[model samples]
Target: WRLAEKAAVTLVDRLICDLALDVDRHSVGETYLAHRPRHAGGFEKEAEATQENYGVAPEILTQSQLSSAGLAGPFYGAMTTPIGFGLNPRKYVAGLYKGAFAAGTRFFDRSPVVQINEKGVTTSQGHVKADKVILATNGYSSEDIPDWMAGRYMPAQSTAIVTEPLSDTALEAAGWTSDQMAYDSRRLLHYFRLMPDRRFLFGMRGGVFSSVSTEAVARTKVVSDFREMFPAWAKVGISHAWSGMVCLARGRVPFVGPVPNMPNVLAGFAYHGNGVAMGTFSGQLLADMALERRPALYPAAMHHPARRFPLGRMRRALVPPVYAAYHLSDLRR
Candidate 1:
């Protein structure tokens, strides 16, 4: 958690310094509360230490404060920046793509890579070899290409749902006036944010497999959880529901470097759901490596070689049991 927090804060600081995009960031710190009283003491102590180290106090909010923030909880503590911020991801990516296109970057859409070697990639259109091949395939990577990459990371599923635009009165009724993004302190955590359009986006970690039935079950659970969290929005219709895979590495950190024994074949992946900033930053590091530029801003851990999963070919089959264990542990939390 410390490493993750440091990586996130560092990336956010770099973004702010570069003026990369209008992140729509807010300093309204996130609240971390639990329904169980046993969790409060540990959280309070941790929050206090974090506040002291970061110079941003983690206020121990009361029940009224938590309620006012649209959080359903027994009061605990809240941490401020550099942990609190919000951004419009769509606009950020769109802007980057537009700029890249203008800079004469020809995008070959729908040309899926069938094979990758040290030289280049063989796509659906045909084989077009090059001097170096950069494998940026994260969660969607196939096992066929570069046998070593297979089973190197666990691709876990994450689900999200968004509600129809709620009115100001509806927002107030839900006690959600703050624009800050919020998440709980569980291993299988729930993340949610109120969009500028008045819609609420809720997400969670579940759905070990990617299938219609799995997605349906995940959606049902997420919607139920959302309703439970914000009773005022219980009747609100869900506008969208979706799910995607997030690559998980052994150390919970991303890797950006040449594939072992295949130096020219550089790869960058395994962000573990922190792809928005970590992915972009890793892309830059990969580019630097390809271009033979200076060293990266991040530590060597960010560029370490990925450790292969022990299950090998049966890795995907083990996802369900792993998810169940994590879910059971979260239930205890």
Candidate 2:
């Protein structure tokens, strides 16, 4: 697991450097700042184990140190980890698309795969013959496309809001002027960051259902949480707000291997919402498998296939109660 984690970061680094991609990547740092004292100890233990196992050093900061680090609020303490950075995921993905295109990878836009057999994929546009097909879609996957994908992946909605660029005065007023990406230690976590452009991005985990009405409610809840965390910026104008699905597996691990009974096909999904890096890493692994080349890194932890959820099509019904339980657990702090 430790080696896989290290390799995941290395793979992304190699992709950016080898492809000469400009992704607006930042190497500032990341902090897991906790708001509750009980969570602070867990952070300390994680920092120690992560440093020992992964060789990335982390500093455990006291409450005063957290405030000194330009984060005001009722934080108990924090564990600031090195070698982790922030990047513009859109730019990174666009860069990948351009690089792959330049390398002679043909793309068919709006051609959703309606069927996948041993020979190729059939889309609404037409059928494309291929020696090997890879299913890379995570949250948007259709269960019936391969039938085996059903009940093996769960999609949950996550919402985020970006504020209009904050002025220096507002930054100081809120005491959150750092460019470091940070999140609190809560079961229902809130990940936030002050982007290079000075816009604050705040996101939260929840939303079992996805719909026009549910999205509005999720946006409202995220805004409420953001305001509660940073009261000084409660009146800030929000420039953008949106929601998207993040995939999960019942096993709580990712799956990257051949689709059952499909010899010429491979599928990878269920990143548990940490897709940017892990997805890239999985793509490399799948490519290696397709090419019959030895994989640079493949951990036994992620080698197993994902298990099916109990409720099948009704698996979404299971999320709300689990989310409610997490909410109640978070309230205990």
Candidate 3:
């Protein structure tokens, strides 16, 4: 929390300095302090609206900060997938949009759309009647969503697990204190991060799961898959494992903002793993557009949901081969 907040403050300080063509970094810092002066008293601090950078924090590379810092990828602001959201989601709850308290209201069945509005939540199932409609469903989508949208999104499942707390010795070995979340560059990655309680929560792409596994059932072979990330738990049994349904898109980017057609009715879904923030950001945009209000501060071209994908079990069959080829390509690269 401290480091993230510090980074945010520094970012703005530097940004203002850059914007006005200030000469020195320290000079900008002094200006920032003067305008947004802080009193090291009993007051709470502010957080940065957004974070910058894509690589791991400097301190994290206890062994090599200087080199590792630059020997990395650019930040997409996607806390879910550091490699960018192509086929996977980031590890943590990098949610930018916190849903409104009025989430499950009756507003969905009306104007904005005639059928399958923002969410799959609706009272009617028959052919929807309205001026126009949009298919915002990503993975859990139904045939009811427009033919175009259905073609665009391919729903898939992902699994995640929070591990047993880390031991003091384990922490010493890992050497990371802050819980900055991280995920890798694979279509299926074992991305994870630290928690204040010292537990390492890990997540990855799991094949379809039809039934739920109890805690006892889940805890059976826990240490195997993730032991490589932290071999310290070789002998420690896995406390638990659980699975859930997550969506994936054609390119993995959320179909935010607006597109050419389907006016009055706006669409936003297919978050890939960027759903949290993307959802919030998209939802806010949707609400503003619906309310006939324009947000001064937000991204343009965000409400546009992707063009849908074709329906069929063909997706499932083709996915294995496609993903395998993709992974093989990665190996070669």
Candidate 4:
């Protein structure tokens, strides 16, 4: 938790200090253990560490306070500000690309990379040789890449479902008027947020198998779980459902450094689902490394090369059993 807080603070600092981006950040504080009291002590310890390190003490709210805020209660609560905010990634990326293009950055859309060697990257149309090549492909990396990358990263799928726009009365009934992003404490957790358009975005970690049948089953389960949790909005219809891959390293940490034995080639990936902020920090670090800048910001562990997974190609087959175990554990909890 401390490491994550530090990394998040560092990213926000860099965005404000170096990039001069006017991030529309909000301070809709988060709540933990809102329905469970057994985990209160551990949560209090976490809040204490966060306060000591970041100078922001989290407030422990009671059931009455949570209910007054239109939240389902029987929870041991802790609230921390300057930690919860939502950014429109689409706008951010568009602005970034526009600036990059204005600064002479070229775009080669739809041109898939065919290979990456000591010389440079090879595209389907042609080869573009360069002195330095930075591979930033996360979960969507091509199979033709180096053995180390193929063996080290496991691409897992994450699924989400968003509802149609809800009326104010419906939102109130669901106890979701706060508009704060929230996630529950569970082995296989559920994350949700109230969108600006009054719709709700509910997501969970599943869909590890890429087959159509498996995805359909996972989607059904997610919808069922959402309905079960938000029974007040039982009649709310799902407008969209989607899934995407997330790269996970064997040690469950991101890596940013030179590929062993691959001269002039650097790779950064395996975000473990916290991609937005962590990826931004990684890109900055990679840029510094490319320019031979001194005094890197992140830790040595983050810069270390990722260790390869055993039975690399067959790792995907283990998803079902792994998810089953996690779900079973959640039930036990």
* Best-fitting candidate, scored by lDDT: 2
What lDDT score goes with residue 36 in model 3?
Answer: 11
Off by over 4 Å in 3: 1-99, 102-137, 146-148, 173-178, 208-223, 257-264, 297-305, 310-313, 329-333
Q: Model 4 over residues 219-241: C-alpha lDDT tens digits?
A: 99889988988888889989999
Q: Candidates ranked by TM-score, best first?
A: 2, 4, 1, 3
Q: Evaluate model 3: give its lDDT.
A: 0.44
Per-prediction backbone clash count: 1, 0, 22, 1
TM-score, every prediction = 0.88, 0.97, 0.57, 0.89
TM-score of 3: 0.57
Compared with the true structure, what per-residue lDDT tens digits does model 2 show for residues 123-183?
A: 9999999999999889889988888888889999999999999999999999987778888
Candidate 3 local lDDT, 1-333, one digit each (tens):
223223334433343334443211211111000101121110122112222332322211211331232212211112111221111123221111111223443334333323444333244444444443434554666544443454566655565676678777766554434334555445455455555556766666545333555332323333455665456555554455666555666655566555344454566766665454455455555666667698644433333455444445455555656657765753442
Candidate 1 residue runs with Cα over 4 Å from true position: 1-30, 48-57, 69-77
State the lDDT of candidate 1 residue by residue for 223-328, as single tens digits.
9988887888889999999999999887777888888888778888998988877787777777788888985375667667888877787787777787678778
TM-score of 2: 0.97
Task: Please identify model 4 stretches exceeding 4 Å from their true place.
Answer: 1-29, 33-35, 53-55, 73-81
* Ten residues in sequence with the least summed lDDT for candidate 4: 73-82
